[model samples]
Target chain A: MSALDALQATLADEHAALYTYGVLGARTSQSATPALYDALTAAYRRHRSRRDQLRLLVQEAGGQPVAAAAAYELDGRLLRSAQVQAEALELEVAAVERLLALVAQSSGTVREWALTEATWSATWQVELGGAAGTWPGAPELA
Target chain B: MPGRPLSRRTTLGSALAAPLALAACDIDPPPRESESSPATPPPPEDSALVAAVVAALVRAQSVLDAAAAAVPSLADRLGPVRTAHAEHLEVLVGAVPEADLPTAGAVSVPAQILPALGAVRRSEQRLQREVREGCLAAASGDLARVLGSIAASTSQHSAALATEVTS
Candidate 1:
């Protein structure tokens, strides 16, 4: 696989990840719900950078950058005020799960790109909501 | 029902971007175990890398084992998954014949959230660090696949634990 292709893959996964956190940020209070806000914002920046990195790689490889999608399927809540935080978590976890599977499929340069994306996505799982931040010594939910 | 198709409005920005970001979602491909072992070589290629994987798997296995043992009724699902991990461990151990992946030995899994999370976090962090470092040390495409698989599994485990806390 090529670097451009891997970057394209990350662009998509991060897109979903970003969308999910957006929902989570709205539903619960920071103090009560957890500082998932910080995690989400960090993810947004990381993903955007990855998207850009992919573009650079594509440009270097003489290939056109992969474009983003029209509208993503968030956990059925786009405008906030929805009971979709858990659903959003599920979606993000599933997205990262898919990326892990994709990395297994690809090889060479593309695989390298896949690994990078998967590693970061997993970190979000721990940091944002699921396990990492949930436990003590974990980033505070307070 | 079938999912939505890649509509025209779903520009390269929307459709393609999602796939790229989640591209690492994958299973750990098995390591290539040769019919014969190699001789010679100094320092070794991936001692740390292999150790990291071994540690993660063992810790994971223990967590699953304890969890399954605690909730023995869930053996229906846990049984198969445990078998799968054992097999995976064998394959991983065989990959680096020279080194023995460290066993958890006597690490106790606390019944409470704090200690439990701490144990899991340590294992997860170790694997994550290895995955990051292994990407740099990998000599073959297969190794990368295995590393990715292990990392994903650890990620899933971490997420699973978090779900318990939330519930």
Candidate 2:
């Protein structure tokens, strides 16, 4: 994909992530599941920060950034800790893939930023009871 | 649900000022042909890049195998890690002719749990560093993507292994 296209995809994933965390974070309480709640809140803020940065990126690149959806689909049954962790893992996996694409298409600090995010995603996976697998992003290659 | 259309055309006037914005956002503009650097050669093909990745995978497999045999108690935790390396090997081998990849010798396992886990963790950390460097050096987009993912995977493994060794 072109650089702009990759950035747009990353922006879209960030939007989805923000929405996902907003849903899941509400269910997690600071008293009941402090770690998970903190993680979710931190992820929400990170996604929002990246989303805003990417919107500026697309605009600077002479492309229109896509808008976020009103709501994302999720089963309310994912109230359990394991279920929420799994959902977070899935979102990170998708984000890593898009970030890897951006890494390929970018250079300088943008590439560095993507690499940092990729590492963070993998670390998060281990925390969520998953291995980074043989491949974190490019499973098709594996 | 569908997203509501949000027109950002209010910023249309900012297009003329995009170059400064791009710089501020760390988005470099496309380089002109005349401004291309002559020092750097283009990215090598997949086969060329596969050698380093394959070497790292082989070393990782050997280390994990030895580590597993040494500390049977940690086998459960190490099992998925070993499998991950094997899968990486499979993918790397497919990138090039079999003859080009190195044949790894079996390394002897350490006698104790901490030592074995430590060895495995060190090997993983080394592999992570090499793979990250390889990813940065890779010119081919596909090769870079694979290397980047491998680097991320190795980082994950190394981090978890560190915890295993300590805890």
Candidate 3:
């Protein structure tokens, strides 16, 4: 994939991530589950910032950024705090995959940015109560 | 579900094709390139980059091993991080020739458990930075992807170690 295409693809994933986190944030009660609420809120904001950055990157690369879908299908019901955290973990894992692709398709400053973002995404997985895998983004190694 | 698109599969397939091929092979010595061979070989610096990362992993593994030995109580916590570095070393060792591989030097652990754990955490953070730099400097996208993944995994290790030290 071209660098621009990779950026757009990552942007699309960020959009879905933001939407999912928004849903999760709504379900989490700050008084009852303060930690989970904060994590979800932090994730939502991070994804939003990433989405905007991708838009600028796409434009600078001489391509029109892909638009976010109106809605995306959630993987599972977010009824419980555990369920909400699990869903957020899933999103971050998926984000790591997308950012790894971006690293693979781009070079120089773009690749550096993707690497930093992928590291943060992987760290977020642990913050969300997931195991730290030997290979965070490269599942083929696993 | 917001399923990943097919393009990601294609991208990863193309990007990882080289390293995955290397990973699948036995640890046989790589065949020397002949004048008649038409295949484009990776730049010399790529090999150097991989070798440097392999050395870093070896050092990190040694540090973890020493820390675990000094503090039996924290072995369970240090086990996964050690395993991760070992696995990373195995994969990267395939990328460089046997002759170019670096040996693991002696590493010492502090007598106190907390200080030993703190030392291990610093080692992981240093390894993480080295791998991240290697990822950024890699010439081949395949190498960059692999290094980037390792960097991410190392960062998680560092974070876990920090949490363990404080908690």
Candidate 4:
């Protein structure tokens, strides 16, 4: 994948994450837990910012940024705090995969950015009680 | 997924250097019939990366083992941390040629919980640096991706350990 392709893929993931966090933030029961609502809100903002950055990256690489899907398929059973955390963990892991690809495709400052983003996603996974996986971004290889 | 390889490609004027550049790439192109040959040895930098990864895995295991033994209260939380290191060790070991595998000598752990956390955090920071350098030095894209993923995991481990220390 080219640097442009990696950026586009990351953008797509950011969009899905933004949408999912929105759903998670709105669920009254999930938000009722102390600090859960705040965490979701912060996550939503972070994704939005990342999405915007990815757009610029794609454009700079002379590629048209792909648009988000109309709707993402999220499980309806994210009722409990643990379930929500798990879902969030899944999303972060997905982001890490794309970011790792970017790291392989790009170099210099672009690679540095991708590495930082990868670290951020894995940290999010850790916050959600997920293990610091051996292969944070490349599970297929693992 | 390799995009247009931004670097490592030789220009027209550098045709004379093409052979060396091609040799730098780790994977050998398929040989024609009756020309079977063994794989080339790993470059020095790549071998160094494998050794660094092994050292990191050992450090993590040692520090976590000491921490768990010292603080029984935090032992439960340490399970996943120890497991993560072990898993990382397994994957990294698979990267090294059997004959070239580096030995990871034992490490001493701090006695107090706070000091142990600090030791683990410092070791993780060092490990992250090694992985980052390994990613930058990797000859193949796949190797770079793996090293990058490991670096990211180290970052997460540091963050999680921080929370444990604070809480």
Candidate 5:
């Protein structure tokens, strides 16, 4: 896929991730919800920077960027404070992994850019460990 | 370094790599066809109960797996829990009925993870509650000996989960 396509993919994911986090942050009922909110916002911020870089790359490649979605569907059960948080975290991990796949699919200078950005996004997970559940040394855990 | 895949795909360029990819999927070695499927076998209620007991262990393992994923702060504590479940599975598999030969299944990592202790702790507690209850239900039945064993495991799991949740 083209760099523009990869960027668009990442942006789409960003749009979804931000929404998930927003819902979770707003609705979560725990005393420590503040911590979750902080981590989510930080992740959103990092995603935004990448989105900007990808947008420029997309324009350079003569592709229009994908538009962000206004809202997302949440599993009804996740409406609860705890479930929402887990659900949002799930979305982030999925989005990150999917974009990484797009990076692997890319070529040329676009490939380097995508890969570099992918690593950066993934590294952020150290603060928020992987959704992969109890494997080994997971990074980017929040 | 930790995120690296256990067996990464080399990507031999599609066509040439297809064979290797297939090989890497851990396809089971060829199986000799059983002379015939066992039928009208004895109640093996004992074995059935044992299988359920074992399934309970796997259920617990799955729960611990999820707990570990959702909250990484308890990773150290979760390790022993995982071992306990694994050993439980091993024992149950050993005792399962002939009709219920063990089936190999996939063990996937939970797709959502948060390393921060607060988030991790909450998620783990929730999932721990789920597994503790599930394992107990799975093991409790007319097969008291087998079911009883699983109940015991669940009790241990419940104790651990409760400690974490209340704390």
Candidate 6:
């Protein structure tokens, strides 16, 4: 994939993440599940910032930024806190995969940025009550 | 996922360079052009970066082992971290030819559980930084991808360790 294509792919994934997190946040109650609520809120904001950054990166690379879909498919029941956390973890893992591709396709500052983002997403996997896998972004290695 | 175009070439070159680089570590010999075929040039820089990362991983594993031994109660918690390091080392070693790579230096762990966990966490954080730097410095995109994933995994280890230290 070209660097621009990788950026667009990541941007698209961020859009799905933002949409899913927004729904997850709504399902979470601050009073009943303060920790999950806070985690979702933080993830939502981070994805937003990353979306914006990716848009700029795509433009800088002389490509049009990919548009976010109107809606994304969600699986399983998200009514429970555990379910919500699981969904968020799944999204974060997907984000890491895209960011890893960006790291491989790009170079210099862009690659550095992708690597940093991938690291954060990997940590988020653990924070969301997921296993800290041997390989976070590279599934082949795992 | 689609594979990178250069991945095959890079992997082959890295596999070939691994044993030579590990062997050079003991002798500290100069780079030898004749050692590699002209079609597959020796990746001296990548080899060096890989060696450095491998060394760091060895040190991190030793520290975790020492910490686990010092605090038997924390052995269960440290087990997964040690496993992760072992798996990482295995994958890295798989990239190179079979040779005696550098071993870990002596690591002293604190007797106190919390302090010992802190030491392990610090080692992980340092390894994460080094691996991240190596990812950026890597010549091959394939190697960079591997290093990037390793760096991410190391960061997760560091974060997990931090949580353990505090809680």
Candidate 6 per-residue C-alpha lDDT over A1-142 given as tens digits, one digit per residue, 9 for 90 to 100: 5566677878888888999999999999999999889889998998999999999988888888999999998889988999999999999998888898777666678889889898889998878887777878777555
By DockQ, is 2 or 3 better? 3
Q: Which ten residues in a row are the worst by lDDT in model 2 chain A?
A: A133-142
lDDT of 3 at B66: 90
lDDT (CA) for every model shown? 0.50, 0.69, 0.77, 0.67, 0.44, 0.78
Model 2 clash pairs are none
Using DockQ as the measure, which candidate wins? 3
lDDT of 1 at B38: 27
DockQ of 2: 0.24
lDDT by residue (B1-167, candidate 4, tens digit) is: 33233222211112111212223212212222232223444444555666777776676677677677877766877776677667666666655536354445666766776777777778778878877877766544455666787788778878877777677
State the TM-score for model 6.
0.87
The DockQ values of the predictions, listed in order, are 0.16, 0.24, 0.44, 0.26, 0.01, 0.30
Chain A TM-score of each model, in the order shown?
0.58, 0.90, 0.97, 0.90, 0.70, 0.97
List iRMS for all predictions. 12.3, 9.1, 9.6, 7.9, 18.9, 9.3
Kindly list the per-residue Cα lDDT of model 2 for residues A29-54, writing each as its tens digit: 78988888888887788788889989
Which candidate number has the best lDDT? 6
For candidate 1, lDDT tens digit of each residue in B1-167?
00123232222112112222223323222333432122322123544555666776787778766655555554454454355457557756665556666767655566654555565557556756666466445443334445565555555555655555566
Query: Which residue pairs collide, candidate 4?
Result: A1-B1, A1-B2, A1-B3, A2-B3
Q: Return the DockQ of model 1.
A: 0.16
At residue B68, candidate 5 shows an lDDT of 68
Q: Candidate 5 - CAPRI tier? A: incorrect
* Model 1 chain B worst lDDT run, 10 consecutive residues: B10-19
Candidate 5 structure quality by residue, lDDT tens digits, B1-167: 11223221211111111111111111211222332123322233334444544554454455556556666766676675566456545444533324354443544444444333333344334544443233233211112212222233333343444455555
Regions more than 4 Å wrong, model 4: A28-31, A78-83, B1-40, B65-77, B98-108, B165-167
On the 0 to 100 scale, the lDDT of residue B113 in model 6 is 85
